[model samples]
Target: MKRTAAALAALSAIVLTSGLVPQAKAEEKKPYKIYLSNNFVGNDWRQQMLRIADTVVKKAPLAGRVDLKVENVETTTQAQINSLNNIIRTKPDAILIDVGSPTALNPTIEKACAAGILVITFDQVATADCAYKVESDWSMLPAVQAEWIAEKIGGKGKVFVDRGLAGAPISEQLQSGFEKVLKNYPGIEIVGYFNGNYALGPEQEGVASLLAAHPQVDAILTQGYGSGAIKALQDAGRPLVPVAGGGYNTASLVCAQTEGAQCILETNPAYLSAEALKLAVDILDGKEAKEKHVFVYGPFLSTDPQPSKLYPDVKMQKIEVGTNAFPDLAPGLSLPITPDWVEITPQEAAGS
Candidate 1:
């Protein structure tokens, strides 16, 4: 699995020289083959992430130079490991995967690395030493959310914790971070904990059932189903409470419109898949990456006047503050990616 530095340096020179020379003088460039392996397509966020991965290769720099393939299977370690082994057999120049387990797929990933294939993992990553990882600040975001919720409720209240899908690395990290912060605020009582699964329908149903039994909740801390929590409260004929949520845009917009209902939005964008694609392409082209791991932080948006400097281009439809919430969009819409990060155009988004 280990690549000799001298061999890598020689290949780097060839790639750089090929790019610099005139088309007529340059050697005929063969299209670099890449494969994307997704563990599941359970939610809207997953669907969007796959779309962005497919769309990125059809654009500039990679347009005519890369042949990309995509595959999805059940979210199981064995399933993903099988997929990785098969992809390695195909001998693609690179493979990008959203893994199902942190350590289960490491040995398989090493096999691919030993075959001289560049591997990059995003979303949920493998523990392979050879693979590069690209993801957001999973730890900081949830901790920030927990701290904000505690402060909003005066450090003491009955709070409902809406967790994401079980067994997911990101979900575990977010939950751990949230729990760590809650420990500091002993006055804040966690009345109930439920897994929303990060989808709208299931989340709404779970919140509804919880509301029926415990209607006196003061605040709700949701992983990625804020809109569902809002709808659950509305259906129960109960007033809205201060909630920390992410992913969906409608909940934040609705919160802005409703009087005295405080909300904060921080979504992990699907476009990060495109960034993963870019990183893979760069490495295959023999461009040495400065860092093996990259951490992108999701921008925070709230109903209050947020820091104007962080998100300069972010235009809010109702609150007139931060990014992530758009009232102009229909209900159940995911937060739109920044124009600078558009791998797919508006036409593709509409068609998808």
Candidate 2:
């Protein structure tokens, strides 16, 4: 009996000493319940963002760690608020929002925070102090591209600026960035402004209308796909010029293929959802963020090698076929598809 007891005790001590107990405990930890609340799904960017989030939760690091539920509401502040109210009742471990209005969701977000639910807003983030924000640095997107345009056009040219979507905070922010950079270059003249609304049809129409009015446009600073501007210039029989726009796959491909086209495409990556998911898991696992606002700055894609003085630290990669820009993919697909942590193929990103 003494020998048997001694052997059992020895075996138990070996298991504990070998760290097997802790490892088993860690493996047994339950996955966190996370909810993604999105307001709009009208554009390719928003759709891609949702797809990326779905892909992320099924991959490693997040695959077994998160039980993610996506709740997409109508493109209205009130609709999102209503959806959030229902989400709050479920009391998931965390709630991630892509806000329709920055401040309109504050009251609802506060209610979520009050109930001890972690709230994280990304992309079009909210203004709730209690909710953490993970978003692209909007100021950099326009500033770097604007600086490149000023240099490409030799600091003097008639430039058309896209005002983006009406009444959107990001639109104003981008417009502000563009103006702030161009103000330094006295020779550069912003002759026309249009509402691109971040859609191809509106962007093309807006640019075409501007082209008809301004006979001497030297460059275009578009807030959406640069392809629309290219098509507008082509249809108007005007010479292809330098353009600064968003990093859409078609835009980069068009810039590369079109002769005499000088372009800079900035990315607001869809992987931000993945980032938010990771952050929620980290916080749930007892890791605290140093700051409430987590700023993710994407790469500056250029058709030609045009370095920036304003943003020296930013990654500026030359757009290439089958690399940064895929020719076989959908036009509306966002570029730089995969985040660094995971390997999401272009097919997966494009939902092919």
- Model 2 accuracy (lDDT, Cα): 0.90
Give all TM-scores, in the order shown: 0.85, 0.92
Tens digit of per-residue lDDT, candidate 2, span 97-156: 998888989999999999999999999888899999999999888999899998988999
Misplaced by over 4 Å in model 2 are 1-26
lDDT of 1 by residue, 304-348 (tens): 533333234433233442444555554555555532644465345
Backbone clash pairs for candidate 1 read none
186 Cα displacement, candidate 2 (Å): 2.1
- For every model shown, the clashing-pair count is 0, 0
Highest TM-score, which number? 2
Q: What's every prediction's RMSD, in angstroms?
A: 8.9, 2.7
